[model samples]
Target: MTIHPPDRRDFARSVPVRLWDESFAADPLRHYQALRNQGPVGWGELAPGVPAYVVTDRRAALDVLHDEETFSHDPRAWEATVPDDSPVLGMMRWRPNALFADGAAHVRYRTTLIDVFDLVEPHDLRGRVHRAVRLLVGRIGPRGEADLVGDFAEPLMALVFNDLFGLPESQGDRLHSGVGKMMEGGDRATVGEAEYAQYVLDLIAAKTERRGDDLPSRLLDHPAGLTREEVTWQVFLTLGAGYGPTANLLSNTLSRILGNPLYYSTLTDGARPVMDAVVEVLHHETPLANYGIYYVRRPVAFHGVWLREAVPVVVSYGALGILAEREATERRHPNDASHLSWGAGAHACPVKQHTLLLVTEAIERLTQWLPDLDPVVPRDRLTWRPGPFHRSLTALPVRFSPRSPASEPSGVRS
Candidate 1:
């Protein structure tokens, strides 16, 4: 898959596409198409003055994701170049966790995470999700009209993840608000990042004094012998990583399911599984749309473009979704899980099963309780949150038949 290098004149005349603009947030596909028009690798600005080479072509993206030696995950070089107050710094700055590590360090951090999460059985995780969903549904079920993003998906994730990480359920709002603002990368990003950091620091401090049967305590006691600071960063990465994308997945899946009447009917009647709708969203409108960030140590020619040293080379997962749809054939089923939404190679997402279980169970429980739920606005008309990295909705308004908490099933009420 070789692409001819653009001539110097074309490169000189090209302008970097701005990804943080409201226009891109509203209709990212249009911006993605424009980026693709530039070449396999195109120039993009994540924020003002932060330029990166966005990989829009599928093959080129795969090459970057797979070749870890050529492209590093550590962002210290790039971090040094960016401003301390850059909104993107909250996400792009180097951390001791696996997301920003490489080689032995990456393996060690990743092993600890996998081991701790593996301790949680599927049934136990499902029960946690069910309980959280029931509580959220109980709150909103009586209201009849609810914004699924705020009232359901976002809070549900906070409740479940907070419980898993040993934080009191009361802190769920802090978790949601902090992570949401931090991922959005804007005026409030610094405040959001500080709130989230304090939340994690408090959790680690509490767990250190009195350990519990939770992810944080387990990481603290692991044989790998991680330090307090190391454990804090791991918990920070896991909680933040789990919350934002999973919430978006839940909301995005719900939006797709409710937007199509036939699909909703099929889903309720058991003709089509909820996983199909989830996969469709993963293929076409994945959450965490454009966050696969990498950097090279030196200038290198990759798939025709000369990548500058230390500049970010982001895999445009949203753009890859577009190419996947265009090249999709009958042989590839709609439920195919070949999408790069979970990413690829060494840095691929490790908690996919837990995420899938939580989302699917949450949807099942909500739909079962409020079977007559309807969307207040069309999917296309729904507004998205503005940020370069995430494809999230600002709100997902839905309406349903109002029901009393006392009328719900025995275990549903809070």
Candidate 2:
């Protein structure tokens, strides 16, 4: 595995293809297939002079993910000459959180997070999901039309996480606004970032002074003995990672459940369960499409792609899904749990099961409440959020028969 120097022309030359382009976002499967056909690895511009190497091959992506010594998650290991004001810096730049750590620090941060998350029993989380869904559905059930992503999925996730973190309604609203602005990305993103940081710190301080059964208190009491800043960042990472991605998954999965005939029939006729639909969505349209931005530790090459020290290599999970589907019919188990959507190696998402359960319970309750739900617009009319990391819809509008406020079930408090 020899790593050659980067071609000067690679940066100077006009790139006819960009993975983050609107066309790719519109029809990613076609673009991913084209990339796969082109080669095992392809270079594209994330921004001008900002080159990223995308591994479309599953085996090559696995190699990149598992090769922690050679490929690091820490941006400090990067030697690339990116400017200070690079728009993607908020995402790729190093943070003290586990998402950007490597080696001993990664282990420490990850261990503390895992311990905190383990305190949340699965059954308890499920009950929270159920209650949150029922309450959310009750609010929108009176209206015949709704945007599932905005009106349902996002709020339900926020509510569940708010309970999990023991945050008051006021703080939760601030957290939601801050996170939403940050995700939108712009000059104002810094403002949102600062606001979110302050909120997290305040919450951590409160938990330390008045320890409770919430995740923050559990994190503060963890054996890792994390610092105040560490705890704050961990809380930010946990909530940010869990809620946004889970909501996106639910939105994407719900789209399929309503749009795909096979999936719709499964729900209507009870041939395939909603969980099965979720598995299918994970395989086909993973919420986090392309991520795992690991920086090259040293000059090395794998599968004929020259990776330089400091350059970011991304795992094309969306492309991997397309590859899986291309060969799905040949697989002995079509629904095997080997997809890279949750990522791979030591950096894999720890809350995968909880996220799946959250999605399952939300979809189950939603369909039960509104079984006749249908999309307000054709699936093709829907547009996706323009970003490199996530496959999210801006909104998911749907219509169903209106329910009377009187129909609210007994003791289901909103």
Candidate 3:
């Protein structure tokens, strides 16, 4: 059944709420809930003087995600309403990648990418993850103190991605650094983006001769007629999207295990499955908080809010996911995979299985290697990154008793 937009007259009565404020970045969940109380949709600035329509309503978010007809993933299709200088343009800019395409373009890009991912054997990926875990744990297990974010999760995820892409550790590190700077918009963003793009092109060029069972080779050899630029953008998107969330998942959940006594005991005692803990972390503290940007194709009203042509529509994923979690908690329900963590529709993340296996294995290995891990600082004292799109800690300093060499898990390569 087709869902038509609301009347324009209906939108005239509601006030646009501010969302790009510092308070929103610090504590988006609280602000989003307050916005929800105001109405289903509201206006906010994505960057200074750059207006966007923020959708906090669950049903409205789903509709926007699924309905690509009225909304477009391609920001270039929009009229020149947003200034070229807007910081958010860095994020919303058009790319030949699957992320910003629609219709046949989206299909072709997504098909090639998914086919490549399908080539990954789960057991092999798990082994790769374990190797990464083993390397990281071996480095820190003897120290008895570690910053989980810096010393473990980030580098471990980098190694896993390096394995997947057939890239050397040094090249992968540079790629990650460039991507991070680009995502962190400012004076450095333009240079970061250019350097990152150059790195991708160089990586793809290098991979053509050193072909193997890696993603870049698979995409390059796909039946689909993708341009070299398309292949590079797809790889960039995959690496950029995959690493941050996976690393955040590992660090955040590890923090929970170390800081929350009750939750830690439940996992260690085997009263709950480890997967259950992973699911709860996804539900309560979704790694990539706000994402899924869609521009209004034309002037339309949706869920009592007016969406003007070319205006950005931002989905509050963290807020909505936590709301779903609260509902489940109230009902005493088992963890459901329907949370908005992976997003909602055609544009949803395609590598759920890969992400899950990577995070799960990493967490399990950490817990087993350091059963007595605990936080170095109070839970409230831990710092978080000040951004609307990500929910990540600045650091996760933790301490643990050194495990004996004989106590290390079996099948973990030294």
Candidate 4:
């Protein structure tokens, strides 16, 4: 008897949340456009499941993300791809680490982070954020021009996480590398998950030895309890949560704002519109394109698609770009509609305030410092870094200068 080979139906069109694909690994927006053309929910060929619904439409994407009872964060399809000793899973299993768990668990886990997150809102950390931003811009001024990703974006973002975790400045590089690996999804190979994992292990050990009163120590000492592995996993999540996506936002927003330098004026003048612009930028580019979570509960039906119970659910952070673009076209208040970048429901990023504050602060400072910020390369000529999980720029080469070339450094006089 001859066996039939698998057909196109076997391939899942939507890629796994973090798996890097050449098509998207090279350009995130383009792939998002392609998926949008296929309609709100398309098949994810790269996904492990038999049928994966790719939600791109704004309302529909909102439906999936916000309605956890119907569309659980626990139903990500890529959990199988994660390593057996998955740091992602470690946090999910922990009590206060219940962001990955459903119902009672998610609520408990959220409480811990939400409390801290509420403290980091734009208003709450305004002084420190401005200071961090000014410090970053000042350093970039000496260089004249720099890759925002490396010099400007990374440092500014890493600063927030470091302060939040109370991790010393000395450990920045290690945490940065580990965050990169975590955001890469399946591309954990390049960063060496084992190495990153070991680093987290060491971080926990150091924190335990030092016995500090920061978030790490709190997780380690949670009354509900967590394992060393659990602390390590959350550390990875926390750092990644603060890094890649925000960096991507900086890179992408810089690209957009430089095209319109007037936003700088808006920010410097204390116009609320500037903050709205920054949030719009986050929604527009979608730094954390997708976030993968495991659904430990029952089945979920999104739209007409029926996802089986206990199925893994990967929540791509932003609505499909093309779909959002179209939705923006239809919006009465196109300026105010959030594009679902921070996600919508029970599992929406608990760190939304921290995330937005980082982006807003970075842009606000950079704009005020260098009103003449402009990309050296054209948009089409520029490239965006790719991965299923992150929509970042590999390198965002930019020139920074004063409003007047005569007043600014000769190096960045565009």
Candidate number of the best TM-score: 1
lDDT of each: 0.87, 0.76, 0.74, 0.58
Q: 1-414 in candidate 4: lDDT tens per residue?
A: 011223212223345332345666655556566655654444443322322445556655666565555544553444555556543343222332445567776676667556545545466466656666666666777667888778877777777667667766666677667666555544363344555566667778888888665678777776656667666766766655666677777777776665555655565565725555656666656676655443424544444444555444454455454355555555356655456665556766677656666666667666656755667876667665544556677777878652332243232212
Candidate closest to the true structure, highest lDDT: 1
Q: What is the lDDT of residue 287 in candidate 2?
A: 78
- Model 3: CA > 4 A from native: 1-22, 77-79, 82-85, 270-272, 326-334, 403-414
- How much is 71 displaced in model 4, in angstroms? 4.0
- lDDT: which is higher, 1 or 2? 1
Using TM-score as the yardstick, the better of models 1 and 4 is: 1
Q: Write the per-residue lDDT of candidate 2 for residues 258-302, one digit (tens) a residue.
A: 987778766755453778778777787787777678877775656
TM-score of 1: 0.95
Provide the TM-score for each candidate, comma-separated.
Answer: 0.95, 0.90, 0.90, 0.77
Candidate 3 vs candidate 4, TM-score winner: 3
lDDT of 3 by residue, 177-267 (tens): 7766565554566677778778778889988767877899888889996877888889988877877778888888777766778877876
Off by over 4 Å in 1: 1-13, 409-414
Residue 347 lDDT in model 1? 91
RMSD of each: 2.2, 3.2, 2.9, 6.8
Give the CA lDDT, 0 to 100, for residue 92 in model 2: 66
lDDT of 1 at 108: 96
